[model samples]
Target: MTIDAKTPEEYISKVPEDRKEAISKLRETIKTNLPYGFEECINYGMIGYVVPHSLYPDGYHCDPKQPLPFACIASQKNFVALYHSGVYADPKIHDWFVAEYPKYVKTKLDMGKSCIRFKNIQTIPYELIGELCRKMTAQEWINLYEQNIKKS
Candidate 1:
């Protein structure tokens, strides 16, 4: 969780032993459902999927040297988190998730603008999560990100 990891394996390995299974399982789900053209790697100290520099030369708006981030999974001290940039950047996406979550999940949702926190792995809705991961292609995300940035 320290953002010191240089690789996905390293990032996962650094998670506390008790949280490893949940972390790995969630990671697997994300990887399996993630859209194409987005590359996986360690970014900002978490296991991140990014739009590679070759695809987006502008990089991250805040840090041009880095690839534009799409999503990330991390095990924090109190909870495991899934960060999807799309849900925050696009209102329609955010609304879709919010509206659809209750239909798929029985437990109360614990989420922020871009992160969904899970304290209990059993309560996590893997199917809905995967759908969110696959909702848009890499190019679609780029356009959405750019549109949001311009509006800002």
Candidate 2:
């Protein structure tokens, strides 16, 4: 995915035309499903929905300003990836996710510490993704972020 962001708007603008539409869709999904006390910004060269420090003073990875523990959407050369740090840290969440969203597994999926990757927009289970986002409360996210930080 292309991050290349100097600013949020610029980041969106920089996305290739073929992937921009998918990114736009993901952006809308994130906005519609976001939890309270989160902010949207361009981070790590992509669209990042952030749980700001004010909400979690310890912040992501306990670095305060670093990480930001985001749900990041990116348009990559090979695929689009949805980054959810909090979700990746919890085995129960991960297992439940696969069980709940079988359609996603049917698609081209990749795993990273916090990334869910797809070859294209058609593979994205937007509704389910939204549900997952909605289910992740701020407290759960902060706790997960802290846990992940300590592990790192």
- Number of the top TM-score candidate: 1
lDDT of 2: 0.74
Candidate 2 has what TM-score?
0.84
The per-residue C-alpha lDDT of model 1 at residue 47 equals 89
RMSD (Å) per prediction:
1.7, 2.4
| Regions of candidate 1 where Cα sits further than 4 Å from its true position | 150-152
Alpha-carbon error at 115 in model 2, in Å?
1.4
**TM-score of every candidate relative to the true structure:** 0.92, 0.84
Q: In lDDT terms, which candidate is top?
A: 1
- The digit string of per-residue lDDT tens for model 2 on 17-112 reads 777777787788888888887788877677888877777666656465754666888877788888886667777777777777676557534667
Count clashing residue pairs per candidate.
1, 3
Model 1: per-residue Cα lDDT over 1-152, one tens digit each: 56578888887778988888887888888889988889999888888999999999989988889999999999887888999998988888899999999997777888998998998877778888888998888999999888876334
